[model samples]
Target: MHSINDAAGKILSSRQTVALTGAGISTSSGIPDFRGNNGLWKTYNPSIYAHINTFRSDPALVWELAFMLHDLAASTAPNEAHVALAGMERSGLLQGIITQNIDSLHQRAGSRNVINYHGTVDSAECTFCRIGEPVRRAALPVCSICGRTMKPGFTLFGEPVPPSAYLEARNLASYSDVFMVIGTSAVVQPAADLPFIARENGAFIIEMNSEETGLTNYITGCFIKGPVEQTLPLLVNKLNRRN
Candidate 1:
């Protein structure tokens, strides 16, 4: 509670506040994260199912995972954490969100300035034509332009993060005065470096997670320890009260 108040105070005072979200933010929406105890990666083996090599060699096989992700995103709605962030953005308390999720929950929740670092599950991109189409469950989707198989919109293991998205996220991190890391363990590379970037740029860090992460130990000024779904709304409420 004290931490939430402090975080809200910082956000209210800051010129720019940015949130870097992860899979844990969507877990309450019935989506499982990739690295948790019962994470999807444990069962699916990302090396075999999510790598670009596997996707290139056996696109049909890759579709199995892609379709599953699409159905899950289709089935679930954004949880309170996502809603709170969207509300903050709308109210001008937040600058934007940089997310590691492909769930599209942030956008669905009404957040306009979202940088989806990992891409999205809303559509699939064609390898040859470089065009994208909505994902379909009826069959393995093929590209309309070149008849090549379409790849899921989410970034695969071997693929680079979209350069444009990364640039936007990097700029946001570098400029933000307050940075919130929510529901991530801060382990994965590239995406994981965002908080550090914000820290290097002198941003005050606030972290909300079920447990302490590397950022919690090193950079976090306020560790609002709890489920993000619960903590984030509380922070929003505090900000509202202060206003």
Candidate 2:
């Protein structure tokens, strides 16, 4: 396993550094990842609850899951890993972050240049009227303006990620000199392609997770095995000491 000092050295020497974050990063903040052993998917079948088809046909059924997400986002706070990334951004060590989590914890932790690749749970919008509003605790949320059914800001399964977010994240990946993959197994597509893009562009890849991910053997140059909440802060402290 590569050390945190090694990851810190890469970050320090890189001209442009970017991060790709996943559900694992926010797990420390009390948000359960969907694919882990104890993830919400074990309790709730994602095909039924997270599919756009189900959401469009049976909005109320989908709202059951949405309401739970709303509550979780409301109750949770950004953990040390999120804070460490934000600190890196503030100090100009990290250029930006591209996150697959729907929870807006990175932004809450003060990361300014975050691209929410999976969308966010912080707001809702009407499909008919396109008017956006804050997420509320309702069995079935509706748009006040057009009285149409509301959907959470997150991209449900079968829904396309917003084009702008995809493009921006791609650009960040293509230009990074150091790319960090944090807490994600990175099995999902489009977002999963980012590490490869960085590698193609000559970015040194750093992987930080509790266990080895698919990228660990493939593109990862430095594998720092541990919980990101612990590993990330350690890396940041190393960078700070150097500074």
Candidate 3:
């Protein structure tokens, strides 16, 4: 029930504040969230397009989806929400961002300390040699050394998160004084556990989303309902005034 200004005050006062972001944060940039009313999952069966098994069996099919995503990402630009978070980090009010999104919008927005909890589309990795190459939208990106067909670096369904990213996100959540959940419903496992870990470690939890998520009542200390593009800038403005 706390206002955006109250949340901003908490962020400014906290010694260490971290943001956990998801597809919702990127929606303003025209990226679609995975589980919303118009989410990608609702249109495409994840098992067929986004599962590791599907990738192994039919990488070409998976690449079709990948190319579609790449095109979408290419056409989009970082929105105000992303810019605000990056500004917060630059000002030292926010320590870092942990994101479930595969798009590199946060990085594009100039957030230096970002943990890509769900990996990213910045490159494609060889399934055999594990070597990666920068994504090439004209055709499937391939590894230079082994010439193996490369897969997008994103964490596909049934694939575990990269260990280093997972550990860093967990450590941040455990050590933060304030943890903000932006545009995520907090239903996905592993990443969803971060807020609970933060709360248990005595960090205040804040949520900003267009609708009530599963964790809205259970974990949030402050719930500010709205689009992140609108809400985050207001919060940042409040923080700036306090500073």
True lDDT of residue 150, candidate 2: 95
Q: Which stretches of candidate 3 lie over 4 Å from their true place?
A: none
lDDT of 1 by residue, 130-205 (tens): 8888887878788887888889998999899988898999999999999989999878889888899999999999
Query: TM-score of every model?
Result: 0.96, 0.95, 0.95
Q: Please give, for residues 1-243, the per-residue lDDT of candidate 3 as tens digits.
A: 579987987887899999999888998889887776898888777889998999888888788888877778778899999999999999999998999988889999999999999888777888789777778877767778887778988888888998999999999999999999999887798998999999999999999999998888888999999999999999999898888
lDDT of each: 0.90, 0.90, 0.89
RMSD of each: 1.3, 1.5, 1.4
Error of 3 at 219 (Å): 1.8
Name the regions of candidate 1 deviating beyond 4 angstroms.
none
Q: Write the per-residue lDDT of candidate 2 for residues 6-45, one digit (tens) a residue.
A: 8888888999999999988999899988887999999889
Which candidate leads the pack in TM-score?
1
Give the clashing pairs for model 2: none
